[model samples]
Target chain A: MGIVATSFRDELLAAGLLVPLGADGLYGRAAAFEDVVDALARLIVSLGAADGAARIRFPPIEPRSVFDRTDYLRSFPDLTGAVVTFRGDDAGHARLLAAADTGDDWTELLEPADAMLCPAVCHPLYPTLTGTLPAGGATYDLQGWCFRHEPSVDPARMQAFRQHEIVYVGDAAGARAHRDRWVERGTELLADLGLDVEAVVANDPFFGRVGRMLATNQRDQELKIELVVTVASADQPTAVVSSNCHEDHFGAAFGINTAEGDVAHSACVGFGLERVTLALLRRHGLDVERWPSTVRDRLWP
Target chain B: MTDDVIRAVLAEHGRLAVDVAALDPDADLYQVGLTSHASVNVMLALEDSFDFEFPEQMLRKRTFESIAAIRAVVDGLTRAEVD
Candidate 1:
């Protein structure tokens, strides 16, 4: 919305990293963007290798039943997107065709599918870990395309995005330590990539009245820490990475437990791939060849 | 009074369920239903009402936890502007 943001959007469009669709928020990423994203994913894995996390890849769509258990609707009802399909018979098909001909709301013929687009990478993993943990607990590396219904003109904010996460499931102390360590590690990682970034205490964008209390409680408890970079605007930095301590929220909800039969505490560190790419382009211009040698070596080498 | 002004801003921009007047000076604005989205609106309104922008250091949760805290920060920033 600011002058800097407009120019940055134009830069992204011209660089082939982002292909702007006719719609406001939807944009197609070129190979250059995907190249950066893949390189960053490798960097994340290399950085996390010492932790020995079990690698898992999830589909973009999650089971609706599993998603319902997370109660995301209660907190972020506005951002959830459901997958729908046309499950109609002959009469329904005829009506749908009529609506399409009339240029009316043809989507009314579509019914809800068994799955919904995953809002976060960790949602499906929780259901998979629904039993006792091994010894001191477990750690996982997950990557997936995540969807949120938030549409914005800022290139930093996308309706659909990719997230790479390192998740820890264990005791409270272990989870907290994991979050703290990653908060520091993530800051150093971004700095290594030659971008100006800051780590700040933040809250989720919860919805409505009850959500206010939840957000305040989250901040008061120091549950979320975000690494923000100035991509769209200098005044309002966008969060490129977030380290969240869910405590026992997910563990209890999904019945995940420690070897001692106690509810496990959970923590996750997620890197927003597209956002980080945008930040790099914003900082070093669109041409990767012109970027600082140190940054090029770190990412490309 | 600052409390009156604070209450007016909350009433106009916040989605509170309780009466603004009945709230204690130290009452937690978030606990009484001031969402993060609405907090931004409240912050902008407060800046307009008092004619001073909040510094980055004053943008934390503690700064707007209560009417008293908001008043303290506003008074401090406005006083600094005068000096």
Candidate 2:
């Protein structure tokens, strides 16, 4: 399937999602669009931070072992492009160059002996809450620059994106409630922002043989919902936010048990901060005050 | 699981959603929408909901075929645990 990209990059640039990183695509400064990003992040976290959920922060890069244990590696291994330490002397580089000169792929040189990828969301963080002891469950207000090697360049589905999630672990009822409540609450919040959005059954982009079964189970369970908005196109709305309830998988793996006794089930309300900003820009003009009166009223100081 | 259950279980991948059980047992899992990534997800879900760890040797392909096949594996593991 091919995407009708249709100036999506230009639209986001016009909307202040990008700044000229340079001719090389390695780096570009983020626009002051962050002013809005910070606000959006705050709003999402605040909504998720309710009910006995104590907040925690974690380093951006979670370990490979951690991911492997969670089956995150099994599910979306393709998305995992990682950082590696090359203690190679100059001779090693020369050998790699020679191999490349023979018109072979670059896989030979880029092997990472020890490595990690920035997580897609708070998936890595959920499992870590295991060992911590708490009177109640722990809730985290988390934000990170997550990286995924997605083939879609829809501007909404960026290769590198910002995600903020409110993660909760402990109490199965609380976990399901967190996921169930947010499905309604999140849609209302987005509606208040003045964007017409769709909530649909969605699932993780698991790869390979197991992906089919996973997708079926996902649709069967209706475990995920995509909050979508039509930014540049009416037919193809972008998913700006999501809510997921990951029963007790992470709690069991992390050994995060409840104070009341039992395996802790967990849930997360994850927002693609950048995706929401783009949706906002698509609905209203880039100028803050020029947006719909309702939105402006909600956003104003 | 019965044919209806199998078809429903395999259908969410979009291809097999119609009548996976009608197909022959040897039909490739990928042909029926059991993508490699989704396969891992299904495995994780099985482990989670059933509270059973997957066997290491059975982690290879050719295992996740028809609904009956999955049930056989799940049952064998289940029966073993119960015993």
Candidate 3:
């Protein structure tokens, strides 16, 4: 790691914001960090409460069948984490114990579970809404701990992280408008919280050669926007929030229709709680008490 | 020569859904399915083929939106090199 990343990690560890789990991409959040995360979540909900979105929370794991239907494995096979269990007989268990005693790999005895870790917060929402919508449409506010298989030491990119998303499921215009509105709102919210943030046109990390085309198409169409803040490096800012427009992709896939029987277009604005908290720590020093009074008031008061 | 070189590079490395020969030079490559990831490949191929690095400003979507746009950037970079 470079000087900046190394120092940042040291500062976080010293301040109790991050508790090292002796594993890459895994860290336990201390009270101060969790407080910031919870405060941000409350702030987000307060900002979006008027939208009348049906709030739903989901577990970190989702059905494998539902995940397959979303085509996430096809697009991001490298980042999908499948949940597995030990389905061994007593003899097999004895061998597994022996392997554990010898510190050998016991993963061979594990079997794939019915579910995989949730890749995106919105993945489980579509299948549940698989039908015609009301006249105008429906909106959802979902938050959960989402898991991805990318293991990295970068504090900003965690293998297990929390995501809060306000998803719009409706007509094309409504969905587009919802995304646009949140883009502005999110920028203002971050700014008000005393963080420098910019919303830029961006693309998802698509897989393989064909995925390259998908990323370009996404950018060209302005289908995705990211709220970026300078965390570890000013030159390479990290994206803490993302606003995406799915544009009937999910509607068509899940058979969700509008009142007129047309496929519903969808959009979502997602905030990575840990990334936001890290951004706050990066902007204002690690000491919560020493942060700007206004930021402190917003988060604590 | 530059146009032919651009076409050849894209054909060899673009991983495009459609034939490079069939694409309109001015048409939006992204609209036709040139992905952002593939665009990076196209950029690298152009840089290797022409022996020049693209400036940071030239890395946006507009710089590679079409075959014509890519040709323009390459021409400008090569011209700058010669001058």
Q: Give per-residue lDDT, candidate 3, residue A276.
A: 94
DockQ value of candidate 3: 0.15
Worst 10 residues of 2 chain A by lDDT: A20-29
Q: After TM-score superposition, what is the CA distance of residue A147 in candidate 3 from its true location, in Å?
A: 1.0
- The whole-model lDDT of each prediction reads 0.87, 0.68, 0.85
Ordered from best to worst DockQ, the candidate numbers read 3, 2, 1
Q: Give a tens-digit lDDT track for model 1, residues A55-174.
A: 999999999999988888878999999999999899999999999999999998899998999999989999988999998888889999999988877888889899999999998788
Instruction: Report per-candidate DockQ.
Output: 0.07, 0.09, 0.15
Model 3 CAPRI quality: incorrect
Residue-pair clashes per candidate = 0, 18, 6
TM-score of chain B of 2: 0.68
- A173-237 per-residue lDDT for model 2 (tens digits): 78777787877877988898998978988978767656655665566667788888886567877
lDDT of 3 by residue, B1-83 (tens): 77788888778876666888888899887666565555767877887888888876676678888889988888888899999
- The CAPRI category of model 2 is incorrect
Residue B73's lDDT within candidate 2 is 79
Tell me the spans in candidate 2 whose CA falls farther than 4 Å from its real position.
A1-4, A14-16, A20-32, A93-107, A132-136, B1-83
Model 2 per-residue lDDT at A125: 72
The residue pairs found clashing in candidate 1 are none
In model 1, what lDDT does residue A109 have?
84
